[model samples]
Target: MFLFKKNKDLLEQYTKYLELCAETLDIFRKAIAYSFENGLNEHFEVLAGKVHAMESDADDIRRQIERTMYEQSLLPESREDLLDIIERIDMVPNCADHLATLMTLQRTPINPALKSEIMELLDLAIESFKYTKEAAVDCFLKMEKVKGLKILIDNNESLGDKLEHKMIRTVFAENTGTGEKIIQKDMINQVGEICNLCEHVMDRIVICSIKRQL
Candidate 1:
Protein backbone atom coordinates (compact mmCIF):
# COMPACT_ATOMS: atom_id res chain seq x y z
CA MET A 1 0.00 0.00 0.00
CA PHE A 2 2.87 2.37 0.74
CA LEU A 3 4.35 1.53 -2.63
CA PHE A 4 1.04 2.19 -4.30
CA LYS A 5 0.80 5.55 -2.60
CA LYS A 6 4.32 6.43 -3.66
CA ASN A 7 3.52 5.58 -7.26
CA LYS A 8 0.46 7.80 -7.11
CA ASP A 9 2.52 10.63 -5.70
CA LEU A 10 5.15 10.16 -8.35
CA LEU A 11 2.48 10.27 -11.04
CA GLU A 12 1.22 13.52 -9.60
CA GLN A 13 4.73 14.92 -9.78
CA TYR A 14 4.90 13.88 -13.39
CA THR A 15 1.67 15.76 -14.05
CA LYS A 16 3.13 18.87 -12.48
CA TYR A 17 6.32 18.42 -14.48
CA LEU A 18 4.30 18.26 -17.68
CA GLU A 19 2.43 21.39 -16.71
CA LEU A 20 5.68 23.28 -16.16
CA CYS A 21 6.91 22.19 -19.57
CA ALA A 22 3.71 23.40 -21.20
CA GLU A 23 4.04 26.74 -19.47
CA THR A 24 7.65 27.02 -20.58
CA LEU A 25 6.67 26.43 -24.16
CA ASP A 26 3.93 29.02 -23.88
CA ILE A 27 6.43 31.59 -22.67
CA PHE A 28 8.80 30.60 -25.43
CA ARG A 29 6.13 31.27 -28.06
CA LYS A 30 5.40 34.65 -26.60
CA ALA A 31 9.08 35.53 -26.34
CA ILE A 32 9.77 34.58 -29.94
CA ALA A 33 6.70 36.41 -31.19
CA TYR A 34 7.63 39.53 -29.29
CA SER A 35 11.15 39.35 -30.62
CA PHE A 36 9.84 38.95 -34.15
CA GLU A 37 7.44 41.83 -33.89
CA ASN A 38 9.47 44.22 -31.75
CA GLY A 39 12.99 42.85 -32.00
CA LEU A 40 14.96 41.86 -28.92
CA ASN A 41 13.75 44.17 -26.21
CA GLU A 42 13.36 44.30 -22.43
CA HIS A 43 10.07 42.37 -22.40
CA PHE A 44 11.63 39.61 -24.44
CA GLU A 45 14.35 39.18 -21.86
CA VAL A 46 11.81 38.86 -19.05
CA LEU A 47 9.90 36.21 -20.94
CA ALA A 48 13.08 34.31 -21.71
CA GLY A 49 14.00 34.43 -18.04
CA LYS A 50 10.60 32.96 -17.16
CA VAL A 51 11.24 30.11 -19.59
CA HIS A 52 14.55 29.36 -17.96
CA ALA A 53 13.10 29.47 -14.44
CA MET A 54 10.23 27.17 -15.27
CA GLU A 55 12.59 24.72 -16.94
CA SER A 56 14.66 24.70 -13.78
CA ASP A 57 11.56 24.01 -11.73
CA ALA A 58 10.69 21.08 -13.98
CA ASP A 59 14.14 19.65 -13.50
CA ASP A 60 13.78 19.85 -9.76
CA ILE A 61 10.50 17.96 -9.90
CA ARG A 62 12.06 15.29 -12.08
CA ARG A 63 14.71 14.75 -9.47
CA GLN A 64 12.12 14.44 -6.78
CA ILE A 65 10.26 11.86 -8.82
CA GLU A 66 13.43 9.86 -9.31
CA ARG A 67 14.18 9.88 -5.62
CA THR A 68 10.70 8.69 -4.79
CA MET A 69 10.92 5.87 -7.29
CA TYR A 70 14.12 4.59 -5.80
CA GLU A 71 12.81 4.83 -2.27
CA GLN A 72 9.76 2.78 -3.26
CA SER A 73 11.95 0.06 -4.70
CA LEU A 74 10.18 -0.05 -8.03
CA LEU A 75 11.34 -2.80 -10.33
CA PRO A 76 14.49 -1.84 -12.18
CA GLU A 77 12.88 -2.10 -15.58
CA SER A 78 9.89 -0.03 -14.54
CA ARG A 79 12.16 2.60 -13.06
CA GLU A 80 14.20 2.78 -16.24
CA ASP A 81 11.17 3.19 -18.47
CA LEU A 82 9.70 5.90 -16.29
CA LEU A 83 13.03 7.69 -16.12
CA ASP A 84 13.41 7.59 -19.88
CA ILE A 85 9.96 9.06 -20.43
CA ILE A 86 10.45 11.88 -17.96
CA GLU A 87 13.91 12.73 -19.30
CA ARG A 88 12.63 12.95 -22.85
CA ILE A 89 9.70 15.06 -21.78
CA ASP A 90 12.06 17.34 -19.90
CA MET A 91 13.92 18.01 -23.16
CA VAL A 92 10.93 19.87 -24.51
CA PRO A 93 11.58 22.63 -21.99
CA ASN A 94 15.33 22.33 -22.34
CA CYS A 95 14.99 22.86 -26.07
CA ALA A 96 12.75 25.84 -25.49
CA ASP A 97 15.26 27.24 -23.04
CA HIS A 98 18.16 26.71 -25.42
CA LEU A 99 16.29 28.35 -28.29
CA ALA A 100 15.42 31.28 -26.08
CA THR A 101 19.02 31.61 -25.00
CA LEU A 102 20.23 31.48 -28.59
CA MET A 103 17.94 34.27 -29.60
CA THR A 104 18.50 36.37 -26.52
CA LEU A 105 22.27 36.01 -26.50
CA GLN A 106 22.93 36.34 -30.20
CA ARG A 107 20.11 38.75 -30.96
CA THR A 108 19.74 36.97 -34.29
CA PRO A 109 18.37 39.28 -36.89
CA ILE A 110 15.25 37.86 -38.47
CA ASN A 111 14.46 39.07 -41.93
CA PRO A 112 11.16 40.89 -42.06
CA ALA A 113 10.16 39.06 -45.21
CA LEU A 114 10.50 35.67 -43.54
CA LYS A 115 8.37 36.59 -40.53
CA SER A 116 5.20 34.95 -41.86
CA GLU A 117 6.83 31.63 -42.66
CA ILE A 118 8.84 31.61 -39.45
CA MET A 119 5.78 32.29 -37.32
CA GLU A 120 3.97 29.48 -39.11
CA LEU A 121 6.77 27.12 -38.25
CA LEU A 122 6.65 28.26 -34.65
CA ASP A 123 2.95 27.52 -34.49
CA LEU A 124 3.52 24.04 -35.84
CA ALA A 125 6.28 23.37 -33.31
CA ILE A 126 4.07 24.41 -30.40
CA GLU A 127 1.20 22.32 -31.71
CA SER A 128 3.48 19.33 -32.03
CA PHE A 129 4.53 19.76 -28.43
CA LYS A 130 0.90 19.95 -27.41
CA TYR A 131 0.10 16.59 -28.91
CA THR A 132 3.25 15.17 -27.45
CA LYS A 133 2.24 16.38 -24.01
CA GLU A 134 -1.25 14.95 -24.33
CA ALA A 135 0.06 11.61 -25.49
CA ALA A 136 2.44 11.52 -22.58
CA VAL A 137 -0.24 12.43 -20.09
CA ASP A 138 -2.47 9.75 -21.54
CA CYS A 139 0.21 7.18 -21.06
CA PHE A 140 0.87 8.01 -17.41
CA LEU A 141 -2.78 8.30 -16.47
CA LYS A 142 -3.83 5.27 -18.51
CA MET A 143 -6.34 7.40 -20.38
CA GLU A 144 -6.08 5.04 -23.37
CA LYS A 145 -5.94 7.88 -25.90
CA VAL A 146 -2.42 7.18 -27.04
CA LYS A 147 -3.70 5.49 -30.15
CA GLY A 148 -3.30 7.60 -33.34
CA LEU A 149 -1.44 10.39 -31.53
CA LYS A 150 1.85 9.26 -33.00
CA ILE A 151 0.41 9.65 -36.51
CA LEU A 152 -0.80 13.14 -35.72
CA ILE A 153 2.58 14.13 -34.32
CA ASP A 154 4.37 12.58 -37.28
CA ASN A 155 2.12 14.34 -39.79
CA ASN A 156 2.80 17.73 -38.21
CA GLU A 157 6.52 17.00 -38.09
CA SER A 158 6.40 16.13 -41.78
CA LEU A 159 4.71 19.43 -42.53
CA GLY A 160 7.32 21.20 -40.40
CA ASP A 161 10.10 19.61 -42.44
CA LYS A 162 8.58 20.79 -45.69
CA LEU A 163 8.10 24.29 -44.32
CA GLU A 164 11.67 24.33 -42.99
CA HIS A 165 13.06 23.41 -46.38
CA LYS A 166 10.92 26.00 -48.13
CA MET A 167 12.06 28.70 -45.70
CA ILE A 168 15.75 27.76 -46.08
CA ARG A 169 15.48 27.83 -49.85
CA THR A 170 13.83 31.19 -49.61
CA VAL A 171 16.60 32.38 -47.35
CA PHE A 172 19.33 31.40 -49.75
CA ALA A 173 17.48 32.84 -52.71
CA GLU A 174 17.29 36.23 -51.10
CA ASN A 175 19.76 38.90 -52.22
CA THR A 176 20.91 39.26 -48.61
CA GLY A 177 24.61 38.94 -47.77
CA THR A 178 25.94 35.41 -47.19
CA GLY A 179 26.45 35.92 -43.45
CA GLU A 180 22.89 37.19 -42.97
CA LYS A 181 21.57 34.24 -44.93
CA ILE A 182 23.49 31.85 -42.75
CA ILE A 183 22.17 33.42 -39.55
CA GLN A 184 18.60 33.22 -40.83
CA LYS A 185 19.05 29.60 -41.78
CA ASP A 186 20.40 28.77 -38.35
CA MET A 187 17.42 30.40 -36.68
CA ILE A 188 15.02 28.45 -38.86
CA ASN A 189 16.79 25.20 -38.05
CA GLN A 190 16.56 25.87 -34.31
CA VAL A 191 12.80 26.40 -34.48
CA GLY A 192 12.42 23.35 -36.72
CA GLU A 193 14.50 21.43 -34.20
CA ILE A 194 11.79 22.05 -31.61
CA CYS A 195 9.36 20.28 -33.90
CA ASN A 196 11.80 17.45 -34.51
CA LEU A 197 12.40 17.07 -30.79
CA CYS A 198 8.68 16.78 -30.18
CA GLU A 199 8.46 13.94 -32.68
CA HIS A 200 11.43 12.23 -31.10
CA VAL A 201 9.87 12.35 -27.65
CA MET A 202 6.55 11.15 -29.04
CA ASP A 203 8.34 8.11 -30.42
CA ARG A 204 9.39 7.18 -26.91
CA ILE A 205 5.93 7.91 -25.54
CA VAL A 206 4.43 5.51 -28.10
CA ILE A 207 6.88 2.81 -27.21
CA CYS A 208 6.09 3.23 -23.52
CA SER A 209 2.40 2.94 -24.32
CA ILE A 210 3.00 -0.31 -26.14
CA LYS A 211 5.01 -1.66 -23.25
CA ARG A 212 2.16 -0.87 -20.90
CA GLN A 213 -0.24 -2.89 -23.04
CA LEU A 214 1.97 -5.92 -22.88
Candidate 2:
Protein backbone atom coordinates (compact mmCIF):
# COMPACT_ATOMS: atom_id res chain seq x y z
CA MET A 1 0.00 0.00 0.00
CA PHE A 2 2.78 2.44 0.83
CA LEU A 3 4.56 1.75 -2.41
CA PHE A 4 1.34 2.21 -4.32
CA LYS A 5 0.79 5.55 -2.67
CA LYS A 6 4.30 6.66 -3.45
CA ASN A 7 3.85 5.72 -7.08
CA LYS A 8 0.60 7.64 -7.10
CA ASP A 9 2.35 10.70 -5.72
CA LEU A 10 4.92 10.52 -8.46
CA LEU A 11 2.19 10.36 -11.05
CA GLU A 12 0.62 13.45 -9.56
CA GLN A 13 3.91 15.29 -9.63
CA TYR A 14 4.36 14.32 -13.28
CA THR A 15 1.00 15.87 -14.02
CA LYS A 16 2.07 19.03 -12.23
CA TYR A 17 5.22 19.12 -14.29
CA LEU A 18 3.13 18.90 -17.42
CA GLU A 19 1.00 21.77 -16.17
CA LEU A 20 4.13 23.87 -15.70
CA CYS A 21 5.06 23.40 -19.35
CA ALA A 22 1.84 25.07 -20.41
CA GLU A 23 2.36 27.81 -17.86
CA THR A 24 5.91 28.42 -19.00
CA LEU A 25 4.81 28.56 -22.61
CA ASP A 26 2.10 31.06 -21.80
CA ILE A 27 4.53 33.27 -19.94
CA PHE A 28 6.94 33.20 -22.84
CA ARG A 29 4.18 33.88 -25.31
CA LYS A 30 3.20 37.02 -23.45
CA ALA A 31 6.75 38.13 -22.92
CA ILE A 32 7.52 37.73 -26.60
CA ALA A 33 4.39 39.62 -27.55
CA TYR A 34 5.25 42.41 -25.17
CA SER A 35 8.76 42.64 -26.54
CA PHE A 36 7.40 43.03 -30.05
CA GLU A 37 4.85 45.58 -28.97
CA ASN A 38 6.94 47.52 -26.51
CA GLY A 39 10.45 47.12 -27.87
CA LEU A 40 12.26 45.47 -24.94
CA ASN A 41 11.68 48.30 -22.49
CA GLU A 42 11.36 48.09 -18.73
CA HIS A 43 7.87 46.60 -19.12
CA PHE A 44 9.32 43.92 -21.35
CA GLU A 45 11.97 43.29 -18.76
CA VAL A 46 9.27 42.67 -16.17
CA LEU A 47 7.61 40.18 -18.49
CA ALA A 48 10.92 38.49 -19.16
CA GLY A 49 11.46 38.25 -15.44
CA LYS A 50 8.21 36.32 -15.20
CA VAL A 51 9.43 33.91 -17.83
CA HIS A 52 12.63 33.42 -15.84
CA ALA A 53 10.67 32.71 -12.69
CA MET A 54 8.40 30.21 -14.40
CA GLU A 55 11.32 28.41 -15.95
CA SER A 56 12.88 28.12 -12.50
CA ASP A 57 9.60 26.81 -11.14
CA ALA A 58 9.38 24.29 -13.94
CA ASP A 59 12.90 23.19 -13.15
CA ASP A 60 12.00 22.56 -9.56
CA ILE A 61 8.96 20.53 -10.56
CA ARG A 62 11.05 18.52 -13.02
CA ARG A 63 13.59 17.59 -10.34
CA GLN A 64 10.83 16.62 -7.96
CA ILE A 65 9.22 14.45 -10.60
CA GLU A 66 12.51 12.75 -11.34
CA ARG A 67 13.34 12.03 -7.73
CA THR A 68 9.85 10.80 -6.96
CA MET A 69 9.94 8.47 -9.93
CA TYR A 70 13.27 7.06 -8.78
CA GLU A 71 12.05 6.47 -5.24
CA GLN A 72 8.73 4.93 -6.26
CA SER A 73 10.26 1.79 -7.81
CA LEU A 74 8.19 1.62 -10.95
CA LEU A 75 8.88 -0.90 -13.70
CA PRO A 76 12.06 -0.09 -15.54
CA GLU A 77 10.33 0.50 -18.84
CA SER A 78 7.68 2.72 -17.36
CA ARG A 79 10.19 4.79 -15.39
CA GLU A 80 12.44 5.28 -18.38
CA ASP A 81 9.55 6.24 -20.62
CA LEU A 82 8.35 8.84 -18.15
CA LEU A 83 11.84 10.23 -17.86
CA ASP A 84 12.16 10.56 -21.64
CA ILE A 85 8.83 12.30 -21.99
CA ILE A 86 9.52 14.63 -19.09
CA GLU A 87 12.87 15.58 -20.55
CA ARG A 88 11.26 16.48 -23.87
CA ILE A 89 8.56 18.39 -22.09
CA ASP A 90 11.35 20.22 -20.31
CA MET A 91 12.73 21.47 -23.65
CA VAL A 92 9.55 23.32 -24.60
CA PRO A 93 10.10 25.99 -21.93
CA ASN A 94 13.70 26.46 -23.00
CA CYS A 95 12.61 27.89 -26.31
CA ALA A 96 10.60 30.41 -24.39
CA ASP A 97 13.52 31.19 -22.15
CA HIS A 98 15.78 31.77 -25.13
CA LEU A 99 13.29 34.01 -26.86
CA ALA A 100 12.66 36.07 -23.75
CA THR A 101 16.33 36.53 -23.02
CA LEU A 102 17.61 36.93 -26.56
CA MET A 103 14.98 39.37 -27.78
CA THR A 104 15.56 41.75 -24.90
CA LEU A 105 19.02 42.35 -26.25
CA GLN A 106 17.77 43.46 -29.68
CA ARG A 107 16.01 46.53 -28.30
CA THR A 108 15.62 47.83 -31.82
CA PRO A 109 12.20 49.27 -32.47
CA ILE A 110 9.96 47.32 -34.83
CA ASN A 111 8.25 48.97 -37.75
CA PRO A 112 4.51 48.51 -38.13
CA ALA A 113 4.46 46.10 -41.07
CA LEU A 114 7.21 43.88 -39.69
CA LYS A 115 5.69 43.97 -36.24
CA SER A 116 2.38 42.72 -37.62
CA GLU A 117 4.04 39.89 -39.46
CA ILE A 118 6.07 38.93 -36.42
CA MET A 119 2.93 38.97 -34.30
CA GLU A 120 1.30 36.53 -36.67
CA LEU A 121 4.28 34.27 -36.42
CA LEU A 122 4.18 34.43 -32.66
CA ASP A 123 0.47 33.60 -32.72
CA LEU A 124 1.05 30.51 -34.82
CA ALA A 125 3.83 29.41 -32.49
CA ILE A 126 1.46 29.80 -29.54
CA GLU A 127 -1.12 27.75 -31.40
CA SER A 128 1.45 25.00 -31.87
CA PHE A 129 2.04 24.97 -28.11
CA LYS A 130 -1.68 24.54 -27.49
CA TYR A 131 -1.57 21.51 -29.73
CA THR A 132 1.42 20.23 -27.82
CA LYS A 133 -0.45 20.37 -24.53
CA GLU A 134 -3.33 18.56 -26.19
CA ALA A 135 -1.00 15.93 -27.55
CA ALA A 136 0.55 15.47 -24.13
CA VAL A 137 -2.86 14.86 -22.57
CA ASP A 138 -3.93 12.49 -25.29
CA CYS A 139 -0.65 10.66 -24.92
CA PHE A 140 -1.43 10.11 -21.29
CA LEU A 141 -5.09 9.03 -21.34
CA LYS A 142 -6.08 8.69 -24.97
CA MET A 143 -3.25 7.59 -27.19
CA GLU A 144 -5.71 7.34 -30.07
CA LYS A 145 -5.90 11.14 -30.16
CA VAL A 146 -2.17 11.51 -30.68
CA LYS A 147 -2.10 10.41 -34.32
CA GLY A 148 -4.45 13.17 -35.46
CA LEU A 149 -2.55 15.73 -33.39
CA LYS A 150 0.66 14.67 -35.05
CA ILE A 151 -0.76 15.77 -38.40
CA LEU A 152 -1.86 19.12 -36.99
CA ILE A 153 1.40 19.70 -35.15
CA ASP A 154 3.38 18.79 -38.25
CA ASN A 155 1.37 21.23 -40.33
CA ASN A 156 1.97 23.92 -37.75
CA GLU A 157 5.65 23.18 -37.86
CA SER A 158 5.68 23.61 -41.62
CA LEU A 159 3.78 26.85 -41.36
CA GLY A 160 6.18 28.12 -38.75
CA ASP A 161 9.15 27.41 -41.00
CA LYS A 162 7.61 29.22 -43.95
CA LEU A 163 6.84 32.21 -41.77
CA GLU A 164 10.35 32.21 -40.41
CA HIS A 165 11.80 32.29 -43.89
CA LYS A 166 9.46 35.05 -44.97
CA MET A 167 10.26 37.12 -41.89
CA ILE A 168 13.97 36.65 -42.31
CA ARG A 169 13.71 37.99 -45.83
CA THR A 170 11.53 40.79 -44.58
CA VAL A 171 14.12 41.65 -41.97
CA PHE A 172 16.86 41.80 -44.54
CA ALA A 173 14.80 43.79 -47.00
CA GLU A 174 13.98 46.50 -44.52
CA ASN A 175 16.03 49.69 -44.77
CA THR A 176 17.48 49.24 -41.32
CA GLY A 177 21.06 49.54 -40.12
CA THR A 178 23.27 46.48 -40.62
CA GLY A 179 23.42 45.71 -36.94
CA GLU A 180 19.66 46.10 -36.51
CA LYS A 181 18.90 43.82 -39.44
CA ILE A 182 21.18 41.16 -38.05
CA ILE A 183 19.51 41.39 -34.68
CA GLN A 184 16.04 41.20 -36.21
CA LYS A 185 17.03 38.14 -38.20
CA ASP A 186 18.22 36.43 -35.06
CA MET A 187 15.01 37.39 -33.28
CA ILE A 188 12.98 35.89 -36.08
CA ASN A 189 14.96 32.69 -35.81
CA GLN A 190 14.30 32.49 -32.09
CA VAL A 191 10.57 33.04 -32.56
CA GLY A 192 10.35 30.28 -35.15
CA GLU A 193 12.43 27.95 -33.00
CA ILE A 194 9.73 27.89 -30.35
CA CYS A 195 7.36 26.20 -32.77
CA ASN A 196 10.02 23.83 -33.95
CA LEU A 197 10.68 22.75 -30.38
CA CYS A 198 6.99 22.26 -29.80
CA GLU A 199 6.81 20.01 -32.84
CA HIS A 200 9.88 18.20 -31.62
CA VAL A 201 8.16 17.42 -28.33
CA MET A 202 4.98 16.33 -30.10
CA ASP A 203 6.92 14.08 -32.42
CA ARG A 204 8.33 12.24 -29.43
CA ILE A 205 4.83 12.04 -28.01
CA VAL A 206 3.54 10.41 -31.19
CA ILE A 207 6.26 7.83 -30.92
CA CYS A 208 5.41 7.20 -27.31
CA SER A 209 1.87 6.53 -28.44
CA ILE A 210 3.09 4.00 -30.95
CA LYS A 211 5.25 2.35 -28.34
CA ARG A 212 2.32 2.21 -25.96
CA GLN A 213 0.26 0.39 -28.55
CA LEU A 214 2.99 -2.07 -29.51
Candidate 3:
Protein backbone atom coordinates (compact mmCIF):
# COMPACT_ATOMS: atom_id res chain seq x y z
CA MET A 1 0.00 0.00 0.00
CA PHE A 2 2.81 2.39 0.90
CA LEU A 3 4.63 1.52 -2.29
CA PHE A 4 1.51 2.21 -4.30
CA LYS A 5 1.12 5.62 -2.68
CA LYS A 6 4.76 6.44 -3.32
CA ASN A 7 4.44 5.45 -6.96
CA LYS A 8 1.39 7.62 -7.32
CA ASP A 9 3.18 10.62 -5.82
CA LEU A 10 6.21 10.10 -8.02
CA LEU A 11 4.05 9.82 -11.14
CA GLU A 12 2.32 13.07 -10.26
CA GLN A 13 5.64 14.81 -9.84
CA TYR A 14 6.82 13.42 -13.17
CA THR A 15 3.65 14.63 -14.87
CA LYS A 16 4.12 18.12 -13.46
CA TYR A 17 7.66 18.19 -14.78
CA LEU A 18 6.43 17.01 -18.18
CA GLU A 19 3.84 19.79 -18.26
CA LEU A 20 6.52 22.33 -17.48
CA CYS A 21 8.57 20.98 -20.37
CA ALA A 22 5.60 21.24 -22.70
CA GLU A 23 5.00 24.85 -21.63
CA THR A 24 8.62 25.70 -22.32
CA LEU A 25 8.42 24.16 -25.79
CA ASP A 26 5.23 26.10 -26.55
CA ILE A 27 6.91 29.35 -25.53
CA PHE A 28 9.88 28.53 -27.69
CA ARG A 29 7.76 27.80 -30.76
CA LYS A 30 5.83 31.06 -30.34
CA ALA A 31 8.97 33.11 -29.90
CA ILE A 32 10.60 31.51 -32.91
CA ALA A 33 7.55 32.10 -35.07
CA TYR A 34 7.26 35.71 -33.93
CA SER A 35 10.92 36.35 -34.65
CA PHE A 36 10.61 35.05 -38.21
CA GLU A 37 7.37 36.83 -38.97
CA ASN A 38 8.32 40.26 -37.63
CA GLY A 39 12.08 40.18 -38.22
CA LEU A 40 12.25 42.48 -35.22
CA ASN A 41 15.61 42.26 -33.47
CA GLU A 42 14.21 43.41 -30.14
CA HIS A 43 11.95 40.36 -29.86
CA PHE A 44 15.10 38.30 -29.61
CA GLU A 45 15.77 39.76 -26.17
CA VAL A 46 12.28 38.92 -25.02
CA LEU A 47 12.63 35.41 -26.38
CA ALA A 48 15.95 34.98 -24.61
CA GLY A 49 14.31 36.01 -21.35
CA LYS A 50 11.56 33.41 -21.86
CA VAL A 51 14.10 30.71 -22.61
CA HIS A 52 16.08 31.62 -19.49
CA ALA A 53 12.96 31.40 -17.37
CA MET A 54 12.16 27.99 -18.84
CA GLU A 55 15.67 26.78 -18.16
CA SER A 56 15.37 27.83 -14.55
CA ASP A 57 12.06 26.02 -14.28
CA ALA A 58 13.55 22.88 -15.79
CA ASP A 59 16.41 22.98 -13.30
CA ASP A 60 14.02 23.27 -10.40
CA ILE A 61 11.97 20.35 -11.69
CA ARG A 62 15.09 18.23 -12.10
CA ARG A 63 16.03 18.86 -8.49
CA GLN A 64 12.51 18.10 -7.36
CA ILE A 65 12.50 14.80 -9.21
CA GLU A 66 15.83 13.84 -7.73
CA ARG A 67 14.56 14.54 -4.24
CA THR A 68 11.36 12.61 -4.81
CA MET A 69 13.16 9.65 -6.26
CA TYR A 70 15.48 9.50 -3.27
CA GLU A 71 12.76 9.97 -0.68
CA GLN A 72 10.31 7.51 -2.22
CA SER A 73 12.91 4.81 -2.66
CA LEU A 74 11.14 3.83 -5.88
CA LEU A 75 13.65 1.63 -7.56
CA PRO A 76 12.98 0.79 -11.16
CA GLU A 77 14.49 -2.16 -12.99
CA SER A 78 16.54 0.23 -15.08
CA ARG A 79 17.34 3.34 -13.05
CA GLU A 80 19.74 4.69 -15.69
CA ASP A 81 17.10 4.46 -18.39
CA LEU A 82 14.62 6.36 -16.25
CA LEU A 83 17.13 9.05 -15.39
CA ASP A 84 18.16 9.42 -19.05
CA ILE A 85 14.54 9.86 -20.06
CA ILE A 86 14.01 12.57 -17.44
CA GLU A 87 17.24 14.32 -18.32
CA ARG A 88 16.37 14.39 -22.04
CA ILE A 89 13.03 15.96 -21.21
CA ASP A 90 14.90 18.57 -19.15
CA MET A 91 17.29 19.18 -22.06
CA VAL A 92 14.57 20.43 -24.40
CA PRO A 93 14.41 23.75 -22.55
CA ASN A 94 18.18 24.07 -22.42
CA CYS A 95 18.35 23.59 -26.19
CA ALA A 96 15.65 26.20 -26.63
CA ASP A 97 17.79 28.59 -24.61
CA HIS A 98 20.73 27.95 -26.91
CA LEU A 99 18.60 28.72 -30.00
CA ALA A 100 17.34 31.93 -28.39
CA THR A 101 20.89 33.00 -27.65
CA LEU A 102 21.71 32.65 -31.34
CA MET A 103 18.72 34.78 -32.22
CA THR A 104 19.80 37.37 -29.68
CA LEU A 105 23.15 37.77 -31.42
CA GLN A 106 21.74 38.25 -34.88
CA ARG A 107 21.78 41.82 -36.20
CA THR A 108 21.19 41.24 -39.89
CA PRO A 109 18.40 39.59 -41.84
CA ILE A 110 18.26 35.81 -41.92
CA ASN A 111 18.36 33.96 -45.20
CA PRO A 112 14.91 33.29 -46.65
CA ALA A 113 15.62 29.60 -47.00
CA LEU A 114 16.97 29.36 -43.47
CA LYS A 115 13.99 31.21 -42.02
CA SER A 116 11.43 28.91 -43.64
CA GLU A 117 13.25 25.73 -42.64
CA ILE A 118 13.83 26.88 -39.10
CA MET A 119 10.15 27.58 -38.64
CA GLU A 120 9.24 24.15 -39.99
CA LEU A 121 11.76 22.49 -37.70
CA LEU A 122 10.39 24.36 -34.70
CA ASP A 123 6.85 23.35 -35.60
CA LEU A 124 7.77 19.68 -35.88
CA ALA A 125 9.70 19.82 -32.61
CA ILE A 126 6.73 21.36 -30.86
CA GLU A 127 4.44 18.64 -32.22
CA SER A 128 6.86 15.97 -31.08
CA PHE A 129 6.80 17.42 -27.58
CA LYS A 130 3.02 17.65 -27.59
CA TYR A 131 2.66 13.97 -28.30
CA THR A 132 5.41 13.15 -25.80
CA LYS A 133 3.49 15.01 -23.08
CA GLU A 134 0.33 13.18 -24.07
CA ALA A 135 2.18 9.88 -23.89
CA ALA A 136 3.44 10.71 -20.42
CA VAL A 137 -0.04 11.65 -19.23
CA ASP A 138 -1.56 8.61 -20.85
CA CYS A 139 0.99 6.38 -19.20
CA PHE A 140 -0.45 7.19 -15.78
CA LEU A 141 -4.09 7.31 -16.83
CA LYS A 142 -4.43 4.70 -19.58
CA MET A 143 -1.37 2.80 -20.66
CA GLU A 144 -3.18 1.44 -23.73
CA LYS A 145 -3.37 4.94 -25.24
CA VAL A 146 0.40 5.13 -25.24
CA LYS A 147 0.75 2.89 -28.30
CA GLY A 148 -0.93 5.46 -30.56
CA LEU A 149 0.92 8.34 -28.94
CA LYS A 150 4.21 6.61 -29.68
CA ILE A 151 3.35 6.51 -33.39
CA LEU A 152 2.59 10.22 -33.50
CA ILE A 153 5.82 10.98 -31.68
CA ASP A 154 7.79 8.90 -34.18
CA ASN A 155 6.20 10.63 -37.15
CA ASN A 156 7.10 14.04 -35.79
CA GLU A 157 10.69 12.96 -35.26
CA SER A 158 10.91 11.87 -38.89
CA LEU A 159 9.60 15.24 -40.00
CA GLY A 160 12.26 16.97 -37.96
CA ASP A 161 14.99 14.88 -39.57
CA LYS A 162 13.80 15.72 -43.07
CA LEU A 163 13.61 19.42 -42.23
CA GLU A 164 17.10 19.39 -40.75
CA HIS A 165 18.67 17.69 -43.75
CA LYS A 166 16.97 20.01 -46.23
CA MET A 167 17.97 23.05 -44.20
CA ILE A 168 21.60 21.97 -44.13
CA ARG A 169 21.67 21.58 -47.89
CA THR A 170 20.06 24.95 -48.44
CA VAL A 171 22.43 26.64 -46.01
CA PHE A 172 25.48 25.43 -47.88
CA ALA A 173 24.08 26.21 -51.33
CA GLU A 174 23.07 29.82 -50.60
CA ASN A 175 25.63 32.44 -51.48
CA THR A 176 25.37 34.64 -48.38
CA GLY A 177 29.03 35.73 -48.70
CA THR A 178 31.89 34.31 -46.62
CA GLY A 179 31.46 35.84 -43.16
CA GLU A 180 27.68 35.88 -43.34
CA LYS A 181 27.67 32.24 -44.41
CA ILE A 182 29.65 31.32 -41.32
CA ILE A 183 27.22 33.08 -39.03
CA GLN A 184 24.19 31.59 -40.72
CA LYS A 185 25.75 28.16 -40.66
CA ASP A 186 26.27 28.32 -36.92
CA MET A 187 22.71 29.53 -36.34
CA ILE A 188 21.27 26.85 -38.59
CA ASN A 189 23.30 24.21 -36.78
CA GLN A 190 21.97 25.31 -33.40
CA VAL A 191 18.38 25.31 -34.59
CA GLY A 192 18.79 21.90 -36.18
CA GLU A 193 20.31 20.70 -32.93
CA ILE A 194 17.21 21.81 -31.04
CA CYS A 195 15.08 19.61 -33.27
CA ASN A 196 17.52 16.76 -32.80
CA LEU A 197 17.23 17.09 -29.04
CA CYS A 198 13.47 16.99 -29.24
CA GLU A 199 13.65 13.74 -31.19
CA HIS A 200 16.10 12.39 -28.65
CA VAL A 201 13.66 13.08 -25.82
CA MET A 202 10.83 11.40 -27.72
CA ASP A 203 12.96 8.34 -28.37
CA ARG A 204 13.89 8.15 -24.71
CA ILE A 205 10.26 8.32 -23.69
CA VAL A 206 9.40 5.45 -26.02
CA ILE A 207 12.24 3.41 -24.60
CA CYS A 208 11.20 4.15 -21.03
CA SER A 209 7.61 3.13 -21.75
CA ILE A 210 8.71 -0.13 -23.35
CA LYS A 211 10.89 -0.92 -20.35
CA ARG A 212 7.96 -0.27 -18.04
CA GLN A 213 5.81 -2.61 -20.10
CA LEU A 214 8.38 -5.38 -19.99
How large is the C-alpha RMSD of every model relative to the true structure? 2.4, 3.1, 3.0
Clashes of each: 0, 0, 0
Off by over 4 Å in 1: 1-6
What ordering of candidates by lDDT runs from best to worst? 1, 2, 3
TM-score of each: 0.91, 0.87, 0.82
What are the clashing pairs of model 2?
none
Against the true structure, candidate 3 reaches a TM-score of 0.82
Cα lDDT, model 2, residue 150: 78
Query: Once superposed on the true structure, which residue ranges of model 2 sit more than 4 Å away at CA?
Result: 1-7, 105-112
lDDT of each: 0.82, 0.74, 0.69
Error of 3 at 85 (Å): 1.2
Model 3 segments more than 4 A misplaced: 1-6, 76-81, 106-109, 137-142
lDDT of 1 by residue, 97-192 (tens): 988888789887567777888789888888888888888777756646776788888898999999989999999998889998988898888888
Clashing pairs in 3: none
Evaluate model 3: give its lDDT: 0.69
* Window of ten residues with lowest summed lDDT in model 2: 1-10
Error of 3 at 179 (Å): 3.9
